[model samples]
Target chain A: MPREITGFSNPLIKRVRSLRDKKHRRREGLFLAEGLRILAEAEEAGFLPEMLFYARESAEHPIVRRLVRATEAAGGDVIETIPDILHKLSGKENPQTVIGVYPERIVPLSALDRSSADIWIVAQSLRDPGNLGTILRTGDAVGAGGLILIDDCVDPFSVEAVRASMGALFTQTIATARWDEFVSWLRAGPGQLIGTSLNTDQDYQMPTYQRPCFLLVGNESQGLPTTYEKDCDILVKIPMLGKADSLNAAVATAVMAYELLNQRRAR
Target chain B: MPREITGFSNPLIKRVRSLRDKKHRRREGLFLAEGLRILAEAEEAGFLPEMLFYARESAEHPIVRRLVRATEAAGGDVIETIPDILHKLSGKENPQTVIGVYPERIVPLSALDRSSADIWIVAQSLRDPGNLGTILRTGDAVGAGGLILIDDCVDPFSVEAVRASMGALFTQTIATARWDEFVSWLRAGPGQLIGTSLNTDQDYQMPTYQRPCFLLVGNESQGLPTTYEKDCDILVKIPMLGKADSLNAAVATAVMAYELLNQRRAR
Candidate 1:
């Protein structure tokens, strides 16, 4: 039988709610992954949660039941809770069937196997967690090797980002480092560093994306700064046929990523 | 000299704030287009605002000044207001320099010129204004003919959607109709109807998008219903390489739209 959590004051409940904040998430080295789908993806990625919680209504769900059983089999505790408790934890009016507290797994820059993966995405100072999450989903869709965060990008494990990722968070390897450090790492790596700029007349589709290529995109409003733009091996521009100045950062990244994949796949 | 309005209680101020709601937007037959970039795009597309408001700080901006001058020359009121009023109008802490009240222009299905354009997009009951907005932007990016919103969908003129569109709202021709009505129109049209479905094993890339193509996509959760799926000329699937079951609605639309464009462009 799984343990039942009745009160919001429960130490475990406090911990789960605290995971909403970046400070607590980083300090605890754990993040909340909500919904049965996300938890299932995590499990499939061999990333079972440290703790699992499910509502009574959700506990009756077959996937939730299986998740509970699997969690138990994996030496993890499953906590049955009221819907209100879950609603509070998730900050959603209608919370998901299940939520998991998973350990943070950060892949270091040095450990990245650059030679094995064809394309890598490097984002600089990305502000929106939703954009970051969508980028992760796009990256996974295009079979990109991994993602690297330069400078102060949004937290990938945030609820908004994780939800946006649609379980791509579990599949894609994510690394974070300072701008200078990433520049050094890129210099040492075996890949052409490609960047996007509106000033460049060269069309994005014109390029032949060589293997182990690093496609770097800039922040949303300001775009690629001069500091980062100077380090890129090639700069390409997406043609703007309409009056809209630029595509959304995530959308631009997806367009470029898929184009690169399409080129490689066709060859 | 542009009239300066100081009070938040001003009738114009109330009118501007009320534009945030769809009810007001529809009743007034007008919508809010904030930011200099969006306003510029609106002007460039020959969709001048009926009224324009600019903050003192933003008034000094060269583009804002140009917009103000152009609005005045076009026999439109160019009102100078405090930053707080502009912020309230935009619902942003740091509002853009200018906000414009533009008359709503809804293109009817009958008015659509399908013969002149090769690609079109049809979205069925899309709920997320953000996703719909992004799709509109993407559709514009790929040089699609226009967008058709089927059945009950979020208001494309809503601030959330308009902002996400990044001025593409001014460029793309948006049409709305009941699903049944859309089907009748589709049967009468010249385009091939294409859809994405998980049940379909055919890769999306395999198809040569026929001219005057109607690329149909389902809603966020409940994709195209069986009824609608049966109507599609081609049902294709974007491969999920990882655990993510589906891509974001806007991202999916973009990928498909761009792929179709790429195919045509290559030929």
Candidate 2:
């Protein structure tokens, strides 16, 4: 039988709470996810939780009960905690009442694109954890093949990102690839390459991305760096009609990805 | 002369710290904004600060100095304190070394459009504060004329929303308008109404968007509402070639908004 952590001071509980900080996440190589919807998605994706902390209140919830069964069947511990204990352990006043501990995931490039996409998003130097999470969730929803982070991206497995992603991170494939590797892969792919830029001459719709393609988005503030300036095969723009000249990195990337998705379906 | 608070135990400091809570925000009808950039934006937008809290260590920053001057000029109180005190007073560790207490913005609908875009974004049932903030920032950066909250959307002026906006909230006109009033306005505008829906039968390009108009986005989990189903004159989709069925709310809205922006520029 697995151990039941009745208090927040329990070593395992302490370790789980420590994940809210970057250091603990790195040391343990673990992240945290909550909410029944997210847990359900994880279960559907064939993820096995190491521990399932469920609340008495949520025990009646179908998904929560299902998750407990799934974890038990997977040979994991299912610890039932009172609502107050669950809240203390979660550090959230309104805890979801269902928490899971799963291993950290770092998607491989090969596994990311089991099949190609009409448009794939490459995030370079995007540092905000919230933006990264939002982008990953959007990429998953838009059905992008995967996401590529060139350099200096905040870890996608961070707690803030997991909360922002609401579990879409598991559904999306993310790879950390260098620039040289990206270039070679670009040359190998059948899709056209498009990158967002401020002064780009090409309109977003100028090209018909009929096949698999790459849509690269840059940092939160300064866009594509000068080094990658030459790396772009074609520069496209989402025209600006006001003084504010840029969109949020994730939002811009999703829009570009949507354009490609739009074209593919139209054909 | 406005009173200057000098102690950590001051009631003003407690009230300022309470701004971090949603209930406090609702009760006080005020919110806190961090950093010098947001303060400047708020100041420029004529949203006067009632209390300016500056860390004694960073009162010399040019932007911080400017905020001080603006607050003084506007008859607001400027409170200078040690970094620790500022952190305590501001309800955030490190607290940008500076923060300003500003009034909640109530954007009048008539002030939204002028020489700018006829393209607007009406988010119906957007639930995430971060997503709303990202969309607000993205909308400003992409030169969106305005943003209209249709129904069941989080309060856009929430602290999380303002922080995610990245200073874009003060740059554009944002208002909470009823769904019926806003949709009628979009329909009356010079553009076609495009809405993303799981029930859509066409791509965004299918109808050719004969008029300048609004693109309606539904909540992240729930796509555009069934009630607004009939309001969308053009029902379009961003095709999903992968596993996910939808994009994050902000990303999807940005993508849709920019498509309209791109289309306008092409014309």
User: What i-RMS does each candidate reach, in Å?
Assistant: 1.5, 2.4
In terms of docking quality, how is candidate 2 classified?
Answer: medium
lDDT of 1 by residue, A1-267 (tens): 799998989998998999999999999999988998788888787788878999887677888888888888888878999989998889988888798888887788998888867889999999989899999988888788889998889899899999888788888899988888888887885789999998789888898888889999899989999978888889998876666668889988988888788788789
Clashing pairs in 1: none
- Write candidate 2's Cα lDDT for B36-153 as tens digits: 7677777666666788888777767898788888789978888887677677755565567677777776575565653356667778878888888888787776667677787778
Question: Which stretches of model 2 miss by more than 4 angstroms?
Answer: A1-24, A56-70, A107-118, A177-194, A199-202, A207-212, A263-267, B1-6, B10-15, B21-30, B42-82, B107-117, B178-194, B210-212, B231-234
Native interface contacts retained, candidate 2: 0.72
DockQ of every candidate: 0.64, 0.52
After superposing candidate 1, which stretches have Cα over 4 Å from the reference?
A9-11, A75-77
Q: What pairs collide in candidate 2? A: A141-B246, A191-A212, B190-B212, B191-B211, B191-B212, B192-B211
Tens-digit per-residue lDDT, B106-182, candidate 1: 88899989886778999998998889889888888888878999977889999999989988888889898887888
lDDT of 1 at A63: 84
